[model samples]
Target: MPKITDQVSDSGIYLLEIVVPDDFYTEIKKYEGRKFPKGFYYYAGSAQKNMRKRLERHLKKNKNIYWHIDYLTSRFNIGKIFYFNNCGKEFECDLVADLIEKFGLIPAAPGFGNSDCNRCDSHLLYSEAPLDYSHFISRYQSIARFIPSSNDTF
Candidate 1:
């Protein structure tokens, strides 16, 4: 199994979080004291079986454009894409949303709700607050970035 590096992105560079089983929290040890850039990032993903294919579609200059992240790709070319595994269908959606909120970066679109976690209403998703990656450290250790895996290339 490949690692899904945890990621962070700005309009210019995208950070990543590696994908690992939800039960495991080993790699996070490596990110201690490392800094992640702060800015608006569209968080979108699916349970599609092919990671490479999904990344290709996401990297495409023209795509179906369904999720908010897809549309944002137009505004800002996706600088980097992070991949995660064990993020099974059941947990992927909620887990992604949870990570976003737990990190404290304003959910790409907060109009959907203050919290991006699946528990909130999924209507009119929009960000009310500005992107503040620094704020995320308040919620969790800045080191957790090492635990997840994401791609920096394409």
Candidate 2:
């Protein structure tokens, strides 16, 4: 399993890529077209099962916001969140992180992580690849399955 880390929020434009199973689409639809308040970082994360449950945790008003997304969401109106159905596993986090970085995005949480994220002593694993962010944007647009058309320019 890859280690997950939290970053110091920079309040930069961020793209959250959440992976969900096909059955979770219904729940994802609830927040479709919803924009999180600005100054707040959008909380984005993935689950191997039960997207609703995981998302619910994020929505909980009383919960402690540990993840970058959670803390950020509390402050900013999530400009938009992209949901990718049928995705599972932690390695994908790295992929999504790379994609987000391709757009020259900065880390909401920059220095926090464990061994899984740091495969080497000198480099962080999540920082390994130059994300093809545009590819994902295009894929979401082409499929039409993703909520809030990418053209909306959130």
lDDT of 1: 0.37
Candidate 1, residues 48-150, lDDT tens digits: the string is: 4554455545556577755544444433444333334434444445544555565443333333212344553332222324333345434334332322213
In the order shown, what is each candidate's alpha-carbon RMSD?
14.5, 14.2
**Model 2 alpha-carbon miss at residue 34, Å:** 29
Give the per-residue Cα lDDT of candidate 1 at 98: 58
lDDT of 2 by residue, 78-131 (tens): 223444444444434554455455544344333322223442121112222333
Give per-model TM-scores.
0.43, 0.44
The TM-score leader among the candidates is 2
Q: By summed lDDT, which 10 consecutive residues of candidate 2 come out lowest?
A: 1-10
